[model samples]
Target chain A: MAKFKVLAAALGILLVLGAAAAQASGVITLEVEILPGFRISGPGSVSFGSLHPGIPEERELQLQVWSNVPWQLSANYYGTVEAPGIVEVQGRNGTWIELGSSTNLVIWDQPKTDPDGVVIKVPLRFTGSFSHDPGTYDIQIEFAVVPLL
Target chain B: MTRVILAMAVLLLVCCGQALASIAVAPVIIEADQVQAGQVFTVVCSHGGEEPLEVALSLALFDQDAWGRVILMEDEASVARAEEALSLERRRFLLQPGQSEAVQVQLAHADFQHLYAVLFLRPVRPGPSTRLAVLFLLSSGEGTPSLDLSGWEQRGTDLTITVENSGLCHGFWAGELLLFDGEGKLAEKVSVQSGVVLPGRSRGLQVSLPGWVQQVEVRSLQLGDGS
Candidate 1:
């Protein structure tokens, strides 16, 4: 009888731990059936260092992609620098593409290879103009990855 | 009838436990000291909760020494691609409960001859995601660290053991040591302190000795992954 009681008690504790973990996750996000795939990683932010007018500073933001299928990568300006001038986010695909509020283009597309997954490096040039006032100009851009199909 | 009830209860617990983490991944870190460039690999992460989860994959580079030592930056999303020639897996997906997903990571085009990346995971929220990392080690074998027992001293119930990393790489070790009293009887098992040690660095593990344990025997240490 005592052995059975111990087993029952241990089982009860395990159940409680499981229930508590479930509640912890439930309180965090939305309600949807979940699967896995699609993600983006960056250095939280991109800094162009100190720039001078007319002297374009060349920097690189390397983005890694891990999609099981062919995917298209796009970017949009989140908070535009409302200074006299905003920083232009440009990239190198087959040609030079300027990034702006409406210029969400597929700068880096995963090749239709066997795995269809890859990492891409985007070489960017940030130019500040003479009319642009400089304190510490900030620009926020959101990069998105979606299925190409 | 009692056995049936017990079996049913056990099944319920297993199901519920898996459901809790919703996102559980095995072999969290891909330690490939022997892995060469142009090698294609895959990682398997699963979902098991009642709710759907979105597991977004992201890649971050961790600068590692020649010994394949990588310090995972937890809770940090921004990873850079400078100084290292590795590419981490990045993507997002919606997963139903009881679903397993695999993502491929590459490290061929990396800058350094031997570099590593921290593959972090995030669950699209409403639910939760486990804070996990997988290390893509690009190096030749022979960088694994070796641990040596440097000193062992017992002061009362406290036993201080010194473990030194005497190799070119980092070492991770853990297990328990058997303590025997003067009467040649087993006193108790002291947890062999476990942690990672950088090359040539020494660490101390304080194991509690029950009563007066005169002899300590060391055996069966389960060495862990790239520390």
Candidate 2:
């Protein structure tokens, strides 16, 4: 009877340990969220903080796009600046263009090779391929889910 | 079954305790809108975490030497003036977790032009304290002194003339160029006639050597873009 009791206790401990381990091993889904109004300021090496009355400041818009789906991504950028300014999307494009200065904000589009209503579309992978200029802008990057159209 | 459940409960409680102490420094941000000439700009430092860190700050000015070399001004005169213009007061006695504080710095005649300063933040207590720090930079109008270079750069029997502008309201104009010789002597003073260079513009004596000269040494030079 004593031997049976000892065996029963040992079996109970083992079951408890197994259950705890299983709980710890459950899936951990990682996430990467975008900050809408990310900005960086400096009397930076360039820009000098003061645009000569008429000179426009060149800026880059960035967004944080992350996920845990282990899948691919496609992003598009669309926006406008108060003044007719030049904007170049880093990583996706190599050139910058001039946009309207007032409410008639300059529009942009990607893959079109030219400005198209201020909207842009880009393709990327799941592993953090954010906009090149990640920390220097005062604009929002609207990331739309580009489905298989 | 009762014994097994008790064992599992104890294990879960211990694991939870470990998770509670795993907090780390999330992120800290410092931002400012604009910095005006001879003015004070407010700076806000923020931390997104569960603990507070002590912050220390300082400021300086950046300029180029005569030879056009990048230099950071930290001499006693400049440093003292800078400290006076910049004032640091803890906006709040407590920097609650996920909170920030505002600091104000005034730009005076002493601290101007490409102002560069650093705001340091480090944990006052020991342990894994999420330290938050940042750098505050402001651009103000250049603080160049208004100097008069009259008969300053000239050499041998040269027509040396001296002209000086000492006030802040008026500056050197295009007609204010002077001619000097190899020696520190004024040769001829030609006032700028066409363009009106204001106080923030260039004004100096123009020296003209009538004959060939071996060497010229310039002195008493008040060289800067503004007053």
lDDT of 1 by residue, B1-227 (tens): 43222221000011111223335554444555666666766777776457677777776654322222233332234355521344445578777878888777665553333444556555654321223445554545546677777677777778777776666555566667888989988877766644555555676666777667788776547655443
Provide the TM-score of the second chain in candidate 1. Answer: 0.60
lDDT of 2 by residue, B77-187 (tens): 655655665555542334565666666655553434434443323333321111122233343434333545444455564534343444342233222434555675666
TM-score of every prediction relative to native: 0.42, 0.25
Q: All models: lDDT? A: 0.52, 0.32
**Least accurate stretch of 10 residues (summed lDDT) in model 2 chain B?**
B8-17
Model 1: what is its DockQ? 0.01
Q: How many clashes (backbone atoms < 3 Å, residues ≥3 apart in a chain or on different chains) does model 2 have? A: 37
List all candidate RMSDs to the true structure. Answer: 22.2, 32.1
**Ten contiguous residues minimizing lDDT sum, candidate 1 chain A:** A78-87
Q: Per-prediction DockQ scores?
A: 0.01, 0.01
- Evaluated against the true structure, the overall lDDT of model 2 is 0.32
